[model samples]
Target chain A: MDTTQLLKGVLDVAVLAVIQEEDGYGYDIVRRLRAAGLKEVGDASVYGTLRRLYTAGALSTYVVPSDGGPHRKYYGINTEGRTMLAEQRASWTRFANTVSLLLTEQHQPTATIRTIGDKS
Target chain B: MSTTTSPTLAIHDFAAAVRAALSDLPSEDVEELTDGLEADLTEQAEDLDAQSFDPGDAVGYADELRAAAGLPVRGKPRLPSAWTANKLRTWASAQRSNLTRKARSTAIGSRTLDFFISLRPFWWVLRGWAVYKVIAALVIGNSIASTLPSSGTEWVLLLLFVTVSVQWGRGRWLPWSWLPPFRTLVSVCSIIALPLLLVLATAWSSSADQYVEDYVPQGLLLDGNQVSNVFAYDSDGQPLTGVQLFDQDGKPLTTVGDPNATPWVTTYAADGTEVILVPSSDVPGRTGWNVFPLNTVDSVDYYSQPSGEPDLSTTTPAVPPFTQVRPLTQQTPSPTAPPTPVPSSAPPVAPEPSATPTPNSGGDK
Candidate 1:
């Protein structure tokens, strides 16, 4: 049930798509991702992916200070992140189509009889 | 605490655990990674099917954070050496704090030290290094210089000192075979007693400077050999500036024919002109000479400097008599007492050759 490996490749696009709609802090993003049916998503993985995208200049971030709890760090998708999301989505579809066709392709097996008379 | 603990404390503990796991990362990155984790944890904890969160799960969360952040994983299989060292360090710190509770919680002394140390957390950041300087200055003294193995050896010792001291402040004393036992004890004891020792060193350095006017070229000068603080004092203890020395035994000590080049040749220069080398630079740990000189006599195998090369080899016989010590010179006092002024020590460098590393109250492994 752990889709961590599968999720890793597509996470960058998934995160950018979520934040592109609206800015969200860490826990909010996790809740949104879970709601989108990415059930096995780990909390830190999303946080890390968000940080990674922000670091890569694909996303932008800002902090909103708080008194007691730690200040909130909000991430929002920018031009680069949006471009990356589009590119990844296109490639993912192409790859998925190729794999899907192979899965659905039908094949028939054929057999030949051996000629023992020539051997004798 | 059990996993069934309340969500509030669990969130705090979770944050602490995550912080601890991410400790080796850059401070900026750790801050960014941990930002809002507690607030998020609090919200997540409440919505859990069970109202409790196990703090043990924090590491797994940290791993996820690291991975998604494009940081390296903890790896599937841990290297045994690193694992053991990590365990030892953790154990040492916990024990250190537990053991030093009394020292840390005491009245005025601990409070003031803590206040200053807290104000400059950079001091704590380099607590690893400050701990080294304090130990080198106060406890180990000149032994480090002379006993040095090489740069590599020093690097290893430095690494070891940093490793041990970190936990030591917290209260852990690791008794590993590779770390010589006495050094371990000294290091642990030193970290535990550092604040008190620094207070004592500062106080002692000041008073000793007042009582000991080593600049007078009298009071059996210490460490003059390493740097020039030499002044030729007359039979009456009156300094004869720039006067060349004549040993009681009349033996030339250094190749330079000047004691200024090798001032540490003798504690007391005899009545005849003894070259007194006065150092122009400041000493490392503190400024100026103090009367409470370390009895470095045994540790240093003093050589007659005439050859320039230290005569450590057995082939070079008998330590120069009055060759240094003009020990015979202390017996005779100058007829007239010249008024002496105490000057603060300004030794620029402190270096000792480690001919034989002294085993401090332990057998060196």
Candidate 2:
């Protein structure tokens, strides 16, 4: 499955998970996502996901003043978002494990053919 | 050099960079992200400068950071929302409904009533006094026509034209080219020529004195002998007595002939002067007396003062050939005493010789 298409479905969940760890501003969230190996995610996409989650009531926002620049708006996960994140994480783990088990069963036939043909 | 670079300017530049990168997103999302990133970038730049950062290396590091964030180098235009698209649709529908309602109400079937109703809006919008003046001018013209003699109708019409043209002049409703020359012609006629023509008509008609004998009532008597009476009634049931005699001020002379009397006598002399009366006695077999003078009367039947006098100085009679009789005050007595009653068996006494002179006096024994 294409991870890009899958990412669209889970973007809001990812944003909520990142904010749940610790409240962060939009650019900081993008930086952390990049560090965590989601380098393919665009800045506009991350911002769009953050705004969608906020509008959907999964994230709450607050503004903090800055001495050297414009004000910062920080987003944090609420109770509903925390509950949803846990459920998503559990579902992802279960689906990944099931896929791993099916792949292992498919590889067993290839392992038998290699043992019979190569005599190594 | 790093100290000279203002932190405010640095933050503005950083915010602008982020905005340029995310500007293709919806406006609300772009604004939220720009606000958040500006604060984060300012803090990081301040910290890096505090640690003895080289300017050349800082620009490269910022470039790498911008690339990693996947922001566009320049700003992009924002798109409108689903709400805006739906709002435009709703507004168009409302406009169509309003237009349809107006068209339905103003359809051809209702055109006449609609025209009258449409006048209401324009009625208030017009200069109210101009409308009032036009109506007033028409009414005054009609009144003047009705009041004057038949020959004076044209003069009244001329006066109406002059009045209306003058009003139009002050109102500036028409171009000067149309109004000035038209007004000049009407004014000249009304003021100069019309009155002179009226005088000429009066003089010419009066020169040919023609008499027509007709029965008139006693109550129409003005003074002693002069009387006027109606020969017929008009369509409005008013008496159409054209013969009116007046004093110098034009007041109508009083009538002496009784309106209800029967077989009334009316006379016009060769001089066109007239008299009317209800006689007390009739000729043999005549139901009531009716007579007319063959020639001008040397004297009126009675002597009396004029009645219904009008200011005659400014007024000219329409038909000047006929004299309008001054009103009469009393009736004339018969020339002889009436016959006395005789007892049934006795022959009637012969009348005294003196009694013969006064006929129908009734008082003689």
Candidate 3:
């Protein structure tokens, strides 16, 4: 199944995690995410996410002038972003564990069916 | 490998195209989504290792950004006919942004831009005042005596309008979707209203001037009716002739109740004979109609004369209302009074005689 739809919900946390490790500009963060195996990420989506994070006070930005190109706007995660990432991290771990258990026991009947069988 | 301007310029062009695709959005929203877009695109091109990397569809990119950033989608017109207006608007916005970019490239230019931006509040207040005055003058037909507020109610109305305008200027008072078209309407109307307001102001000012000129009372009046002539008598009840009058401010009272009055008038003498009256000439040539006890002239002499000064030779002493009023006596000055012998007796003698002649009896007084 395509992960693009799933990426929308967790893009915020992923972006915050990438910038929390080190300050990076728009394309730099996108490259880091792609190298970390989420190659389906759209460039504009990452740019928009960065802007939203900055607007929401999770990221702080500063301009660094490049030698022969437009000024690069670097984003670094702040205290608020760290707090957000922690919460989302905990929620995602719980969800992943549940999904992992459900997928591993594919042959087992659901709890509701087993209960009905026992009653019968 | 050396860096060339080609890739950077291409990235800038791509970013500009993206901005154009999103031109229908509010300016600040467009800026927020695309502020550092050129740098990002350049990096993406470099990473792809293609000498001529395609930026692809800008409209698609704008939509993705809009969705991810939670901005409202750009509204499309319902009918084909509406596209013309949309196209025109988009073109105007592009021109404005292009001008702004050119202006911001230099230090002085950027500072000038900042200075103008700071004056926006003042412009907002001015716009509100203009709108209020225009509505008041046109719709309510309220007379504008002056531009400044002259009454408490006017001040309150002005404050209310200014508050509303400033809120609208700050983009706070209305829904975002409604603001663009309404703002455009207001801007166009204000432009049209400026010249209209000037015309109305000129008309109002002229009418106000005419009103002032109309109500000013000319010459002298007693109980609302003109005093066509003045009369004088001594304390001894004898009529006083050639009595030149001066008001309290020492201004010579020379004009008559009406400038166009007939030159000759008839009055009864003490012997019940008719005498003709004409305004006495002062200084040999000028008529001093306000001089008390106007000269008496023979009716034949006045009627037979051609235009110009009446025959000064035929002028005679005016007839008094009475040959003898009750003679008034002056009290002797007390011994303690200053020895300069102040002439207080003359004033007291005049008032008693002046009160006896009633004005309504016609210039006979």
Candidate 4:
């Protein structure tokens, strides 16, 4: 299944998690998320999502002027973002466990009945 | 390897489009969104794979930016208008549109209908003001409440008025009734009415001709013995006052009433001046006191030279009548009347015999 739609809802958590480990610029955050296996992440989406987090009080931003090319805008997660990450981390784990159990269940009822007879 | 200026300019153009799309956003958001974008584009341009990473639909980027920032779409931001000014403008525009639409209607009657409709709000506001004033007078307990609408009355009245207006604006009929189609008729008719009412009031209200007659023996007679507060006398059409009243032959007439009656008396005009009083009727078209002009004739000729008292010198004016000085008015009624009577009294007693002597004797006593 495609994950782009799934990515939209969780972009805030993903951005905060990426920047929470270390302060990062917009493009750098996109590269890190892609390297970490979110290949479908768009560069502009990361830039947009970073700005949104900053605006939403979950992230703090500061401008660092470079000697050449573009000045870098760096974002770092604040306490609010860490708390959000914690909650998201817990919910994501719970969701993964529920899905994992569903995938591993027996396909046929006869096998379950034979196992039950042998146990009896 | 450096890129050419054209591609850099194109990147700048792309950035500009995104900024334009975000124009309605707060300045800080625009800055935050666009910061370093050109630099990032330039950096990406060096790598062959990313060099042509043109944003296919750059305007879509602005929507993304807004959504990510948890803000409304760029053009959909609420306009920054205060509630009162917003309401006023909405009402004004509604009325304007209503007027234009009505004016465009093909029927001739519709134009007049629109005119009355346009003026309805003017009546509403005036009605509101008048109603407020009347209520204020009754509740605030003053013959005239303080003129300012908000003042003198309790805020409860204001609240009540506001509630009614809001309901009326929403098309409630219980409050505002159907006004007559002729909204301005009362005022326009009143404009025509005042002079007409005055004509009627003047015509039958008072019997104007009851006191007027074809002939009265005297001209301009005050029906009563005393007339006070007479302002001016008309000559031809020019108004004249303080010009001494003179009879047809020009001798002054003195009116003796209250010591305070206007000093229109003849002797107050001059001493040694002969006078003939014309009855108010003799002047052809005029009917008031008619007096003659003053002439400095020797009183010695008018009255027999005083005898028996040798004080004749004391009684007579040292300024003999022969001198032709025409005196200008001294403000009060001139003292000429008192002196003339004094001179007539200077003759010594035959206190009872000669009628003239007795007249003087009585005057002297």
Query: Which candidate has the top score in TM-score?
Result: 3
- Write down the TM-score of every candidate: 0.37, 0.29, 0.39, 0.37
Per-candidate TM-score, chain A: 0.80, 0.80, 0.89, 0.81
Task: Name the candidate, 3 or 4, with the larger lDDT value.
Answer: 3
Candidate 2 DockQ score?
0.10
lDDT of 2 by residue, B1-365 (tens): 34456765655665565456454555764565454554555555554563442223333333333333333333333234544544555555655554454444556635765676667434322223232223334565432212233446545554564455546546555566656545444444444544544465455455433322234433444344443332322333222333334547864333433323433344553345443333223233322222211111122433442633222223211121112222222342542533232212322222211112222222232
In model 3 chain B, where is the ten-residue run with the lowest total lDDT?
B338-347
Q: What does candidate 4's lDDT look like per residue over B208-283, in tens digits?
A: 4655643343222355332211222232222232334645777433333322232222231122333222222323
Model 1 earns a TM-score of 0.37
**Which numbered prediction scores highest in lDDT against the true structure?**
3
**What pairs collide in candidate 3?**
B237-B325
DockQ (C-alpha based) per candidate is 0.54, 0.10, 0.53, 0.35
**Using DockQ as the measure, which candidate wins?**
1
Q: Candidate 1 docking category?
A: medium
Model 4: residue B225 alpha-carbon error in angstroms: 84
- True interface contacts reproduced by each model, as a fraction? 0.93, 0.20, 0.67, 0.50
lDDT of 3 by residue, B1-365 (tens): 22344776767677888899889878998998898887778778878864667777778999899878766567755454466577668668856765576577679999999999999998788778777886676776767545766678878888888887788888778877868678767767877876766677778789888999889576677777554456565666455777888889987675454534646555554345555556766644344665677776655455566854455467766544444443445663563432221122232222122223343343232
lDDT ranking of the models: 3, 1, 4, 2
Candidate 3 DockQ score? 0.53
Off by over 4 Å in 2: A1-10, A34-44, A66-70, A109-120, B1-14, B17-29, B43-365
Residue B63 lDDT in model 4?
78
